[model samples]
Target: MTPTVIIQLFVFLLAGFVGFQTITRIPPLLHTPLMAATNAISGISLVASLVLAGSNQGLFSTILGTIAVGCATANVVGGFLITDRMLAMFKPAKLEAKESVA
Candidate 1:
Protein backbone atom coordinates (compact mmCIF):
# COMPACT_ATOMS: atom_id res chain seq x y z
CA MET A 1 0.00 0.00 0.00
CA THR A 2 1.05 3.56 -0.58
CA PRO A 3 2.46 5.62 2.32
CA THR A 4 -0.32 8.19 1.90
CA VAL A 5 -3.00 5.51 2.27
CA ILE A 6 -1.30 4.11 5.38
CA ILE A 7 -1.09 7.59 6.93
CA GLN A 8 -4.75 8.27 6.13
CA LEU A 9 -5.81 4.96 7.69
CA PHE A 10 -3.85 5.68 10.88
CA VAL A 11 -5.36 9.16 11.09
CA PHE A 12 -8.88 7.81 10.62
CA LEU A 13 -8.38 5.18 13.33
CA LEU A 14 -7.02 7.68 15.81
CA ALA A 15 -9.80 10.14 15.08
CA GLY A 16 -12.43 7.43 15.41
CA PHE A 17 -11.02 6.39 18.78
CA VAL A 18 -11.03 9.93 20.14
CA GLY A 19 -14.53 10.55 18.81
CA PHE A 20 -15.80 7.37 20.44
CA GLN A 21 -14.35 8.36 23.82
CA THR A 22 -15.77 11.87 23.55
CA ILE A 23 -19.26 10.67 22.61
CA THR A 24 -19.30 8.19 25.48
CA ARG A 25 -18.89 11.04 27.95
CA ILE A 26 -21.49 13.36 26.40
CA PRO A 27 -24.47 14.33 28.60
CA PRO A 28 -27.93 13.17 27.48
CA LEU A 29 -29.12 16.74 26.79
CA LEU A 30 -26.34 17.19 24.26
CA HIS A 31 -27.89 14.45 22.15
CA THR A 32 -30.71 16.82 21.13
CA PRO A 33 -28.43 19.30 19.37
CA LEU A 34 -26.21 16.59 17.97
CA MET A 35 -29.19 14.74 16.53
CA ALA A 36 -30.57 17.92 15.02
CA ALA A 37 -27.28 18.67 13.28
CA THR A 38 -26.98 15.09 12.09
CA ASN A 39 -30.47 15.19 10.64
CA ALA A 40 -29.72 18.42 8.81
CA ILE A 41 -26.59 16.97 7.26
CA SER A 42 -28.35 13.76 6.35
CA GLY A 43 -31.02 15.75 4.55
CA ILE A 44 -28.28 16.93 2.22
CA SER A 45 -28.04 13.38 0.91
CA LEU A 46 -31.20 14.08 -1.09
CA VAL A 47 -29.24 16.54 -3.21
CA ALA A 48 -26.58 13.94 -3.82
CA SER A 49 -29.27 11.54 -4.91
CA LEU A 50 -30.63 14.09 -7.38
CA VAL A 51 -27.15 14.65 -8.80
CA LEU A 52 -26.64 10.92 -9.19
CA ALA A 53 -29.96 10.58 -10.94
CA GLY A 54 -28.85 13.10 -13.58
CA SER A 55 -25.51 11.36 -14.19
CA ASN A 56 -24.72 9.16 -17.21
CA GLN A 57 -24.30 5.97 -15.19
CA GLY A 58 -26.66 3.05 -15.72
CA LEU A 59 -29.62 2.00 -13.58
CA PHE A 60 -27.30 0.58 -10.91
CA SER A 61 -25.91 4.00 -9.95
CA THR A 62 -29.35 5.53 -9.73
CA ILE A 63 -30.61 2.65 -7.62
CA LEU A 64 -27.62 2.86 -5.31
CA GLY A 65 -28.06 6.60 -4.87
CA THR A 66 -31.75 6.21 -4.14
CA ILE A 67 -30.94 3.55 -1.56
CA ALA A 68 -28.32 5.79 -0.01
CA VAL A 69 -30.83 8.61 0.50
CA GLY A 70 -33.43 6.25 1.91
CA CYS A 71 -30.92 4.78 4.33
CA ALA A 72 -29.77 8.22 5.37
CA THR A 73 -33.34 9.30 5.98
CA ALA A 74 -33.96 6.22 8.11
CA ASN A 75 -30.75 6.80 10.03
CA VAL A 76 -31.56 10.44 10.73
CA VAL A 77 -35.06 9.66 11.94
CA GLY A 78 -33.99 6.67 14.03
CA GLY A 79 -31.11 8.60 15.54
CA PHE A 80 -33.41 11.41 16.66
CA LEU A 81 -35.94 9.00 18.12
CA ILE A 82 -33.24 7.16 20.04
CA THR A 83 -31.71 10.37 21.27
CA ASP A 84 -35.11 11.64 22.39
CA ARG A 85 -35.73 8.45 24.33
CA MET A 86 -32.29 8.62 25.92
CA LEU A 87 -32.85 12.24 26.93
CA ALA A 88 -36.22 11.35 28.38
CA MET A 89 -34.55 8.76 30.60
CA PHE A 90 -32.29 11.41 32.13
CA LYS A 91 -34.59 14.48 32.26
CA PRO A 92 -35.56 15.93 35.63
CA ALA A 93 -39.22 16.41 36.42
CA LYS A 94 -40.58 19.93 36.50
CA LEU A 95 -41.62 21.49 39.80
CA GLU A 96 -45.37 21.93 40.44
CA ALA A 97 -45.10 25.70 39.95
CA LYS A 98 -43.27 25.37 36.65
CA GLU A 99 -45.78 22.83 35.41
CA SER A 100 -48.67 25.10 36.40
CA VAL A 101 -47.19 28.03 34.45
CA ALA A 102 -47.07 26.01 31.27
Candidate 2:
Protein backbone atom coordinates (compact mmCIF):
# COMPACT_ATOMS: atom_id res chain seq x y z
CA MET A 1 0.00 0.00 0.00
CA THR A 2 0.97 3.61 -0.58
CA PRO A 3 2.43 5.57 2.32
CA THR A 4 -0.46 8.01 2.26
CA VAL A 5 -3.01 5.22 2.40
CA ILE A 6 -1.20 3.61 5.29
CA ILE A 7 -1.15 6.90 7.21
CA GLN A 8 -4.81 7.42 6.54
CA LEU A 9 -5.67 3.96 7.81
CA PHE A 10 -3.68 4.55 10.96
CA VAL A 11 -5.45 7.81 11.59
CA PHE A 12 -8.82 6.18 10.97
CA LEU A 13 -8.11 3.44 13.47
CA LEU A 14 -6.82 5.92 16.04
CA ALA A 15 -9.95 8.03 15.69
CA GLY A 16 -12.18 5.03 16.15
CA PHE A 17 -10.33 3.98 19.28
CA VAL A 18 -10.48 7.43 20.82
CA GLY A 19 -14.13 7.82 19.93
CA PHE A 20 -14.98 4.55 21.59
CA GLN A 21 -13.14 5.55 24.76
CA THR A 22 -14.87 8.94 24.84
CA ILE A 23 -18.37 7.56 24.54
CA THR A 24 -17.77 4.84 27.11
CA ARG A 25 -16.02 6.99 29.71
CA ILE A 26 -17.97 10.21 29.52
CA PRO A 27 -20.62 10.58 32.22
CA PRO A 28 -24.08 11.88 31.35
CA LEU A 29 -23.73 15.08 33.36
CA LEU A 30 -20.41 15.88 31.72
CA HIS A 31 -21.55 14.95 28.25
CA THR A 32 -24.19 17.68 27.98
CA PRO A 33 -21.83 20.44 29.06
CA LEU A 34 -18.99 19.13 26.91
CA MET A 35 -21.27 18.93 23.91
CA ALA A 36 -22.45 22.50 24.50
CA ALA A 37 -18.84 23.70 24.45
CA THR A 38 -18.15 21.72 21.28
CA ASN A 39 -21.20 23.35 19.69
CA ALA A 40 -19.82 26.80 20.45
CA ILE A 41 -16.49 25.90 18.87
CA SER A 42 -18.22 24.54 15.81
CA GLY A 43 -20.28 27.73 15.52
CA ILE A 44 -17.04 29.67 15.33
CA SER A 45 -15.74 27.33 12.65
CA LEU A 46 -18.94 27.83 10.64
CA VAL A 47 -18.56 31.63 10.78
CA ALA A 48 -14.94 31.40 9.68
CA SER A 49 -15.96 29.13 6.83
CA LEU A 50 -18.59 31.60 5.67
CA VAL A 51 -16.06 34.40 5.66
CA LEU A 52 -13.58 32.30 3.69
CA ALA A 53 -16.24 31.30 1.21
CA GLY A 54 -16.80 34.96 0.34
CA SER A 55 -13.13 35.43 -0.54
CA ASN A 56 -11.37 34.87 -3.87
CA GLN A 57 -10.07 31.53 -2.70
CA GLY A 58 -9.19 28.40 -4.63
CA LEU A 59 -12.02 25.96 -5.37
CA PHE A 60 -10.45 23.19 -3.32
CA SER A 61 -9.97 25.44 -0.31
CA THR A 62 -13.52 26.68 -0.47
CA ILE A 63 -14.90 23.20 -0.78
CA LEU A 64 -12.80 21.96 2.10
CA GLY A 65 -13.92 24.85 4.29
CA THR A 66 -17.54 24.17 3.47
CA ILE A 67 -17.23 20.51 4.30
CA ALA A 68 -15.46 21.31 7.55
CA VAL A 69 -18.23 23.70 8.52
CA GLY A 70 -20.95 21.23 7.69
CA CYS A 71 -19.32 18.38 9.61
CA ALA A 72 -18.63 20.56 12.63
CA THR A 73 -22.17 21.90 12.67
CA ALA A 74 -23.63 18.43 12.44
CA ASN A 75 -21.37 17.16 15.19
CA VAL A 76 -22.24 20.09 17.41
CA VAL A 77 -26.00 19.93 17.03
CA GLY A 78 -26.39 16.18 16.85
CA GLY A 79 -23.92 15.53 19.65
CA PHE A 80 -25.65 17.94 21.99
CA LEU A 81 -29.07 16.48 21.28
CA ILE A 82 -27.79 12.96 21.76
CA THR A 83 -26.03 13.93 24.95
CA ASP A 84 -29.19 15.49 26.31
CA ARG A 85 -31.14 12.35 25.52
CA MET A 86 -28.51 10.17 27.15
CA LEU A 87 -28.59 12.31 30.28
CA ALA A 88 -32.34 12.02 30.38
CA MET A 89 -32.03 8.24 30.38
CA PHE A 90 -30.11 8.37 33.66
CA LYS A 91 -32.47 10.82 35.34
CA PRO A 92 -35.60 8.67 35.44
CA ALA A 93 -33.71 5.70 36.80
CA LYS A 94 -32.05 7.79 39.46
CA LEU A 95 -35.34 9.38 40.47
CA GLU A 96 -37.02 5.99 40.84
CA ALA A 97 -34.17 4.65 42.93
CA LYS A 98 -34.23 7.76 45.12
CA GLU A 99 -37.95 7.40 45.76
CA SER A 100 -37.61 3.75 46.60
CA VAL A 101 -34.70 4.31 49.00
CA ALA A 102 -36.40 7.15 50.87
Candidate 3:
Protein backbone atom coordinates (compact mmCIF):
# COMPACT_ATOMS: atom_id res chain seq x y z
CA MET A 1 0.00 0.00 0.00
CA THR A 2 1.03 3.60 -0.52
CA PRO A 3 2.42 5.61 2.39
CA THR A 4 -0.70 7.79 2.47
CA VAL A 5 -2.99 4.76 2.71
CA ILE A 6 -0.84 3.28 5.45
CA ILE A 7 -0.97 6.49 7.44
CA GLN A 8 -4.71 6.77 6.97
CA LEU A 9 -5.22 3.20 8.11
CA PHE A 10 -3.10 3.77 11.17
CA VAL A 11 -5.00 6.91 12.06
CA PHE A 12 -8.32 5.20 11.50
CA LEU A 13 -7.35 2.35 13.76
CA LEU A 14 -6.14 4.74 16.45
CA ALA A 15 -9.31 6.73 16.27
CA GLY A 16 -11.42 3.61 16.54
CA PHE A 17 -9.53 2.48 19.62
CA VAL A 18 -9.66 5.89 21.29
CA GLY A 19 -13.28 6.48 20.45
CA PHE A 20 -14.25 3.12 21.81
CA GLN A 21 -12.38 3.72 25.04
CA THR A 22 -13.71 7.22 25.54
CA ILE A 23 -17.29 6.28 24.85
CA THR A 24 -17.18 3.24 27.06
CA ARG A 25 -15.75 5.26 29.96
CA ILE A 26 -18.49 7.89 29.83
CA PRO A 27 -21.27 7.71 32.41
CA PRO A 28 -24.63 6.57 31.16
CA LEU A 29 -26.01 9.99 32.11
CA LEU A 30 -23.77 11.64 29.49
CA HIS A 31 -24.74 9.51 26.52
CA THR A 32 -27.59 11.80 25.48
CA PRO A 33 -25.39 14.85 25.26
CA LEU A 34 -22.78 12.87 23.40
CA MET A 35 -25.36 11.71 20.91
CA ALA A 36 -26.57 15.26 20.35
CA ALA A 37 -23.06 16.53 19.68
CA THR A 38 -22.26 13.68 17.32
CA ASN A 39 -25.50 14.30 15.47
CA ALA A 40 -24.46 17.90 14.79
CA ILE A 41 -21.12 16.71 13.54
CA SER A 42 -22.82 14.14 11.36
CA GLY A 43 -24.92 16.90 9.84
CA ILE A 44 -21.68 18.58 8.77
CA SER A 45 -20.52 15.30 7.24
CA LEU A 46 -23.81 14.99 5.41
CA VAL A 47 -23.20 18.37 3.79
CA ALA A 48 -19.75 17.35 2.70
CA SER A 49 -21.10 14.10 1.31
CA LEU A 50 -23.74 15.98 -0.64
CA VAL A 51 -21.06 18.14 -2.22
CA LEU A 52 -19.10 15.05 -3.19
CA ALA A 53 -22.14 13.30 -4.62
CA GLY A 54 -23.12 16.33 -6.68
CA SER A 55 -19.69 17.07 -8.09
CA ASN A 56 -18.61 16.05 -11.59
CA GLN A 57 -16.21 13.57 -10.16
CA GLY A 58 -15.53 10.08 -11.54
CA LEU A 59 -18.15 7.35 -11.40
CA PHE A 60 -16.52 5.54 -8.49
CA SER A 61 -16.19 8.72 -6.46
CA THR A 62 -19.76 9.69 -7.15
CA ILE A 63 -20.99 6.26 -6.08
CA LEU A 64 -18.90 6.29 -2.94
CA GLY A 65 -20.07 9.80 -2.12
CA THR A 66 -23.71 8.84 -2.58
CA ILE A 67 -23.27 5.95 -0.23
CA ALA A 68 -21.62 8.24 2.29
CA VAL A 69 -24.56 10.62 2.03
CA GLY A 70 -27.06 7.87 2.79
CA CYS A 71 -25.03 6.58 5.72
CA ALA A 72 -24.55 10.10 7.14
CA THR A 73 -28.25 10.85 6.81
CA ALA A 74 -29.15 7.71 8.69
CA ASN A 75 -26.59 8.40 11.38
CA VAL A 76 -27.80 11.99 11.92
CA VAL A 77 -31.46 11.09 12.00
CA GLY A 78 -31.02 8.05 14.22
CA GLY A 79 -28.81 9.92 16.65
CA PHE A 80 -31.35 12.73 17.01
CA LEU A 81 -34.15 10.26 17.57
CA ILE A 82 -32.20 8.43 20.24
CA THR A 83 -31.12 11.69 21.88
CA ASP A 84 -34.67 13.04 21.93
CA ARG A 85 -35.95 9.83 23.47
CA MET A 86 -33.26 9.95 26.10
CA LEU A 87 -34.08 13.59 26.89
CA ALA A 88 -37.76 12.75 27.14
CA MET A 89 -37.02 10.38 29.97
CA PHE A 90 -36.05 13.36 32.15
CA LYS A 91 -39.33 15.22 31.63
CA PRO A 92 -42.21 15.27 34.09
CA ALA A 93 -44.76 12.54 33.50
CA LYS A 94 -47.57 15.05 32.94
CA LEU A 95 -45.70 16.83 30.18
CA GLU A 96 -44.76 13.56 28.60
CA ALA A 97 -48.37 12.37 28.55
CA LYS A 98 -49.58 15.69 27.11
CA GLU A 99 -47.05 15.56 24.30
CA SER A 100 -47.90 11.97 23.57
CA VAL A 101 -51.49 12.94 22.83
CA ALA A 102 -50.66 15.87 20.59
On lDDT, the candidate that comes out on top is 3
RMSD of 1: 4.7
lDDT of each: 0.78, 0.79, 0.94
Candidate 2 lDDT over 2-31, as tens digits, reads: 999999999999999998998889985586
Better of 1 and 3 by lDDT: 3
Please give the range of 10 consecutive residues that has the lowest summed lDDT in model 2: 83-92
Worst 10 residues of 1 by lDDT: 88-97
TM-score of each: 0.62, 0.54, 0.88
Clashing pairs in 3: none
lDDT of 1 by residue, 1-102 (tens): 999999999999999999899888989668777777776777787667767866859999988877876887787788778776766666566754575698
Please identify model 1 stretches exceeding 4 Å from their true place.
58-60, 83-102
lDDT of 2 at 76: 70
lDDT for each residue of candidate 3 in 13-64, tens digit (9 for 90 to 100):
9999999999999999888888888999999999999999989689998999
Clashes of each: 0, 0, 0
- Model 3: CA > 4 A from native: 2-4
Which is the leading candidate under TM-score? 3
